[model samples]
Target: MSMQLNRQLPMPADLKAQHPLSPAVLERKAQRDREIREVFEGKSDKFIVIIGPCSADNQEALLEYVHRLAEINEAVKDRLLLIPRVYTNKPRTTGQGYKGMLHQPSPDKAPDLLEGIIAIRRMHIRVIEGTGLTAADEMLYPENRSYLDDVLSYEAVGARSVENQQHRLTASGMDIPVGMKNPTSGDLSVMLNSIQAAQSSHNFLYRGWDATTGGNPLAHAILRGGVDKYGTCVPNYHYEDLMRLLELYGERDLLNPAVIVDVNHSNSDKKYKEQIRITSEVLHSRSHSRELHKLVKGVMIESYLEEGCQPIEGERTYGKSITDPCLGWADTRSLIFSIAERA
Candidate 1:
């Protein structure tokens, strides 16, 4: 054999029992879930903001960010629904570098999967208990999602993983709203196909058991733009792009026809500062087309306590990002209110 097995880890159920959530926390999470669902279901017109750091590398800093989100959620409750991102796993284009907190719970230390699992769970529980915010996470690994299912209110299949079969099938099995981004190639058709798969029940092998999903009707689209053959970033958050999405949704029998503009990534070309301008343009686009306004449910923004990204080595800035650069707390706060004003 080419590989040796490590110690078997505890099941997600057992781990939950070990660090169980309080009734109050569970209830709070349920409420957040429902509010987010209403946006995708068309029962509510309030805009949704799935905003946070690109990778949650530390518990204290992540909690600090979530608590701030809670305060803002209170102010914009009438016009916007806020869901903070506590993503623990990050996708690397070439299969190298820091995987995430799930791989290295302590960034300065070496990777330890066992401790990493417990650390991530505790961090998520802490976020819910302290801030009353059930954050969103990227489903980078389908098998690992069980560890977070109870605490996460939302999930997004990243642009790189949108076409994977396991990702689509697992998303179908999930009950919470899952946003599937258009592939890096900019193929909207592939994205639509993935969504169709996620919204349709399928019998498949999962976690050593035969499982069938009831179809996640809330699975929708996240247009994060894409890269062309020449390796140029092609943005799709414009008025024309949104109208095209509206037309695309019309051709499908998909439920709750909706889309979320990911203001970072290719959409902003990873220029964190562009998030503000992109968001303004998207809100302006909504102002012009009623169809565009109705179809776009929210925006996904990458922001942290400090603005921009930094290297892992050397003296770390207290709240700067270790992964992708993010809008600082000041800019993030201002952007939320601006979105509320326009919404």
Candidate 2:
């Protein structure tokens, strides 16, 4: 075999037993799960902001950041439903550096899957127990979803994974909202198809067993923009883009049709600061056309306590991002208010 034999880690049940969630955390999670579902199901008018660091590199900073979010949620409670991104597993385009807190809880340390699993589970538990918020995470490893499944309010099938059969099948069974993003090559059909697959029943192998999933009605699209053949970034968050997506959605037989415009990624071209501008434009688009206003459910923003990013080695500015660049705390708060006003 090409791979070395790694030791088997403890299952999620045993791990959760060791670090149990308090009744308070469980109550909070149920509340958050319902509210978020209502938005995707078109039952709630509140806008959602799935905002946070691109990668949760440090726990203290992340905890502090969520605490600040709790404060912001107070003022924008009427207009916003916040789902902080505690994205622990980051999908690397080339299988390279800083996979996430799930692979290396400490950036400087080597990969230890067992410790990483415990660390990630603990972090999610803390976020919910400490802040009364059910966080969001990427379904990078389908089998690994078991660890955080109980705590996550939302899960994203990233641009790269949206087309994979396993991701589509797993999403089919999830009760929570799952956002599937357009691929890097700028293919909307692939994303749409993934959503379709997720919204229908499936029989597939999962974690060494035959599993059946009843379609997830909340499965939907997330436009993060895309990269062209020439390697130039192309944004798909304009008024025209929303209209186009709506038309395409109309042509399909889907349920709970909705979209979430990602302010960062290819839309902002990783400029980091452009998140604010892109957000303003998307909200404006949502406002002008009632059709768009109903179809556009929310927006995703990459943000943290500190602005921008730094090298993973020796660079430890508290809340700054170690993966993709993020909008700093000051700008993040202002942008959230602006989005809420328009939402």
Candidate 3:
């Protein structure tokens, strides 16, 4: 006997429509975009801090965290451009893990992608409107870009996807500056190629439509450290390493001249405390290389109201990361002050 297969079909009521960007949010995002551009161009020396939970799983926790961050942002407004990481989607190496708020908001629950998209947009809009601070996020899926294009001030292409043609094409047309992270294996060439791709005009199918992009001149690189067979985190933003990258890219006229250093991830081997120390060292080391100092525009940090992380598939813990561990609020505040003093 043959068995019949059954598949559930989505109902019209179950589909969520894409939300519209409010005029107020658009105006604010425009101002934030200008500020970010100024910093990238050397017109402003403000240190850009992209801080938030590794996975924004809990809306309440994230909102409370951003409220606190807003207060700190005001304190360092003159020297830092604080952009909260309202990241909604996450990429996994082996295709397993929490994913993020947009994928599996409730552990073990089936995905409601339509609702997930709307939820993230609503969250992003609320964060910006409430905190009065700009925001940043990694663009993981090209299809999701439309949901966020109007609200984000800054964007990043993660290490794993930076080498993909689709992501590069997406960056080329981005209104906001985009940072391409170094490859997972710690290869700088991948980032270089990514920057090159993002800087060139491209013709590709985008969002189910034929599209043409003018290319983005503000596309830049990020150093997020690399892993070796010895199980050691190798810092790639050292003065010598940065100088070499700059020099090489300069020779090819492909250098962005503006780079952001990620203090977490492999840079600190996922040790949240080390992120602060490494950030300090990078800032201190900058004084020795004039060219590199001028090129090192900002830093990226993973921080939240609490330190460390909890399993996503288990009982949820408030204020803790559902993905990678992040610096706690106290340490994050201290690091911001230290960065300001040094700057």
Candidate 4:
């Protein structure tokens, strides 16, 4: 066996006990959860903007970003809900590079899984305590969901993991909103199938027990675009693309048939600055048709305090992304108000 056994890590329950959330923080998280779920359930019409750094690598910087977002959230509480993307885990296309805060709590440090888990939880709690908003995180490792279950209000299954059965099953058990992204190959059917699985009851072996999930009706679609066979980026946030998704949803019996367009990734070909234009276009599409207005519930944006990204090795800049390039805070703030105006 080539795999070396690491020290046994503490269970999520034990860790939660060791460093728990305050009562006020718990109440705020619960309220945020309900509001987000209401949007998926069609009970609320407010738009969702899942925005934040691509990978939350620095705790201090991340909290500062969230605090700024909180001020904006207060100003736009009537029209929009801004949920930060405190993505502690990241998916690597080549299985190399920084895997996220879950692998290395500090970008410049080595892998320390135990400390990473604790650090992620603490960072998430701080976001809530300081900003009163629970964030979204990628469900990269389905087994690690419990570590963040209580603190995260939203979960996303990345394009790479969307078709995995374990991800589907784990999503089924989640009580909050879960966004399933189209596969890297841009297969809509694969994403729809994963959504179907997540919206159905399942009994599976999770951790050490036979876990049963009653199905997650809030499971929805997230269009982050995809790569073509020729390695070209294919965007799907256009009016025609959204219409196609609406037609696809019409053919299915899935619940809460909503879509959230990811403004970055292949949609803008990772051009961080393009997020502003992409978001405007998506909102325009939503305005042109009533069907789209209801079907397209929100958007996912990669934004941070500083615009763009930096190399992991040398002289890291504060508040900038260490992973995917992202929109800067100034553009991000303007974009949020723009979305609120049009959404």
TM-score of model 3 relative to the true fold? Answer: 0.92
lDDT of 3: 0.83
For candidate 3, write residues 1-343 as lDDT tens digits. Answer: 5975444433322332335556786788788889989888778878787888887888889999999999988889898888898889999889987677787665468776755776787888889889887788889997677767777888899988998899999999987889999987898888988998998899999866799998898899889998878878787867777787777678666535688999899888898888888888778777677887788888899998889987766576689887899988898888888888886
Runs of candidate 3 with Cα error greater than 4 angstroms are 1-18, 229-231
Q: Which wins on lDDT, candidate 2 or candidate 3?
A: 2
lDDT of 2 by residue, 113-181 (tens): 999999999999988877887899999999999888888999999999999999999999999999999
| Per-candidate TM-score against the hidden true structure | 0.98, 0.99, 0.92, 0.99
Instruction: List runs of model 2 lying over 4 Å from the truth.
Output: none
Question: Which tens-of-lDDT digit does each residue in 1-343 have in candidate 1?
Answer: 9997978989989998998999999899889888888889889999999999999998899898899899988899999988899999999999988899999999999988889889999999999888888889999999999999999999999999999999999999998999999999989999999999999999999999999999999999999999999999999999989988888889999988899999999999999999999999999998888888889899999999999999999899987899999999999999999999997
Candidate 1 TM-score over all chains jointly: 0.98
